[model samples]
Target: MHDQNFTSLPDLHGVPVFYPHGTQLIWISSNGEITRPSRETLAAEFALGVVLLCHRRWSAARAAIDIDHYLDVMELFAFVRPARFVLPTPSGLAQQLGLARPQQGEDMAALLPQIAFILLDELASTPDPARTEAGRIATMMTAGGWKWGPYILAHLGLPQPLAGPPDSRYAAIWDRLADYTDYTPQAEPGTQPILPDAARQRLAEMLGENAELRLPQADYAAAVAASFDRPDAGPNPAMVLAEAGTGTGKTLGYLAPATLWAEKNGETVWISTYTRTLQHQIANELTRLYPEAEAHESKVVIRKGRENYLCLLNLEEALAQMPGRPRQAAALGLMVRWAGATRDGDLTGASFPAWLMDLFGRSQTNGPCRPARRMYSCSLPAL
Candidate 1:
C-alpha cells in the first residue's frame, strides 16, 4: 500500500476526533464519506500514507516534495497524545523553530503539515541523545506502541529514551536563585588610578581605529574616571550627572571609566538603565570587550523586576490544564520548548518571540502564580 509514489494526493483525509476523555482518529473519503477504521486498517492505510509523505519529504537533508498541498493527508496524523503531555500547535512549533510568521492574509493552517514534519525532524535529530522533551515523547511513543511510531523510529532514528523526567538545567537555575543573599560591600583594593587621558585612550581602543574621537565624550569619560578618586573617609559618595543629547556616545563614555575602575579594583560594577531596550543595547556594547558568547554571558548581567520573567511553576500549572484550552496549551507548549533553548530566560527581552507572547495573551507571560516562584534572571560574573 505504501509503494506508490504519491505525485498527487488521493481522496483520503484524516481529521482529529476529540472526545471528552481524549482525541480519537477518523477518516474522511473524497466522496464526503465519514468512517472510523479499525486500528490495524488505519495503520495499513492512513498511517502508511503519512509515513510515506514524511519519508518522501524529510528523509533526506532537505524535503523532495513541497508537502504544502498535502496538509489534508497529514492532518489526522499530527495529533498525538503520549502519556500526558500535549504537543503544541503547528504555529507554536513554527515559533519554537524561530521561523517567521506567515504574511498578512496568508493561511497558516495550510502550512501545519509542513511545520509538524519539521518539528518531528527536530525531535528525531537532537544531539548527544539526552533526555530532552524529544526523547521523552519518543520513549512514550515506543512504549505505547503507537502505529506511526515505528516509521518515525526507523526513518529518523529517534533518540533513545532515558529513564526519569526530562533534564531541566534551566529550571534548576531559578531554583538555585531562591537562596540569593544580600550583596555585601567589600573594601576596594588600592590600585594605581586611571586618569582621564588614560580613560579616553581606553575608550578609543574599544571603539577601534576607524572610530572618530569626540571631544565631549572624552571629557565625559575623564570626569567619570576622576570620580573613582573619592577618599574612603568621604561622608558621601561621588556622583556625576552629565546631560548629553542622543548619539553623543554617553554609553561608551561612562562604560570606559567604569570598566577600568572595576578591572583595577577587582570589583563588581552595576550599570542601571531606565528601559529594557537600553539595557539590551548596553549588553550588546559589552560584546566588543567580550567577543565570545560564553564570555559575554559570564561578564554581563541584565537585571529586571520579577514580573518580567517566566515562572516554571506557573508553566507547569498551565500545562496541566491543556485538555480544553488548545490555544493556551499551544502557547505553553512552545514556552516549554523555548525554556530549554533560552540562554537567560528573560521572557520579554530574551529570544522568546514577541509574536508568540501575543498567542496565549499576556497572562501566561506576566509571571503569575505567586505561591511558589522560580524565575529566569540574567546574570554575568564581573559586570
Candidate 2:
C-alpha cells in the first residue's frame, strides 16, 4: 500500500510503531490495552520498520552516490524508512562504490523503483497479517515483492515528504544516522593462527619496500615485527615506539604486525582511537585484510570510551525508568528506534546529539543497567 501511494515517509513518528502479530494490527499499550492505531499510523510504522531492516542493503547499493547528484536525489533519503533509521554504509564503502552523479534524466518519479526496492526482501519475510486495513496492504506487494513504484502509482497517489514528530529528541538522534546495518552473514571464524613468523612476513610482504607504491616501510614494520617475535622473555611483552611523518604508513605498519601477533597468540588486540571515524577506519581496514576475523568481531575488535555505544537494556527502560520526566515518551521512542536499528550500537550510530545523550546518562530515578565498559560483553544486561 505504501509503495502504491505514499511518496514520503508516513506521518507516524511517536504515533506508536507496531508489527503484524499473526493477523491483527494490535498494539499492547502501557496499560496493556490491545489497541489498533489509525490507518495512516499503521501504514507509516510498517513502512518504517521495513526500511529499518533494509538500511545497510540500501546503502551498499547506493553507497558511492556522486555529490553532484546528492542534492538532486536528497529528498528521496529524507525521513524515509531504513536510511533515516539505521547507520549508513561507512564512508569508505561509499567512496569505493564511486556513486555516480545523477544524470539529467533522473527525477523522483524515475527513482520510485529504486526507493521501493529497498524494502522488497524485508516485506517478503514479514509474517503473515490478517487482511484487516494493514493486511489489505500486504495483499498487493506480498504477492509480488518490490513493486513499490507500480504499487504506489496504482494505489497511493503521491508520496508527500514528512518531518518527524515535533519532539526534538527523535530528530536529534535519528536524523544524523543512515541505515547500514545489513550485509553481515555469520561466517565461520578463522582458525587460530599457528605461524607467527608467517603472519609477520605476510605483513612485511604486503607493505614491504618491494611492494607496489613502496608500502610497509620496512624500517617501521621491522621494529613492530621484532617486538612480537621477541624470544622467550618476561611476562611483560616488548613494546617499541617509532614515529614518522604522514604517508609513512604508520597505521598499517602497526596493524600488520599486531594482526598477526593477535591471531597467533589468541589474544585480543586493542586499537584505541580518539575519534569514532578513525575507529571505523581501522575496523574497515581489518575487514579488508582479515575479513574472517573481523566478521566475528574477534581476532580484532573495536573498544571505545563505552559511553558512545547505545545501551539496548537501558534504552528500553527510558520511560518506565523515569516516568513523567520531560520528553520521556519522545526520548523513549527515539531510543527504541536507535536500539532496534543500530548494528554497532555506537552513539555515533545516529550522530547522537548531546541533549539526547543526557537522556541516557544517570537519570534522577534510574542508573545505568551496568557499567558502560561491560556493554560489549552484555549490552542487554538486566538492571
Best by TM-score: 1
| Candidate 1, number of clashes | 1
Give me the runs in candidate 2 sitting further than 4 Å from their true place: 1-125, 128-200, 204-216, 229-237, 292-298, 321-331, 350-383
Model 2 has an lDDT value of 0.39
lDDT of 1 at 62: 31
Off by over 4 Å in 1: 1-116, 128-132, 135-193, 231-233, 319-328, 365-374, 378-383
lDDT per residue for candidate 1 within 1-383, as digits (tens), equals 02122223222224221101012233444333445555555444433343222221221113212322223212222322111122234344445456665432122333444555564565456565333444343333333323333334433544433323322222232332443223445785655467888899879877989988798888888888867774553677666677777878989998888888777877778887888888888888888778899987777888776677666666665555543443343344445556655655666764555434333565654564254434454222324
lDDT of each: 0.50, 0.39
TM of each candidate vs. truth: 0.58, 0.46
Compare the candidates by lDDT and give the number of the best one: 1
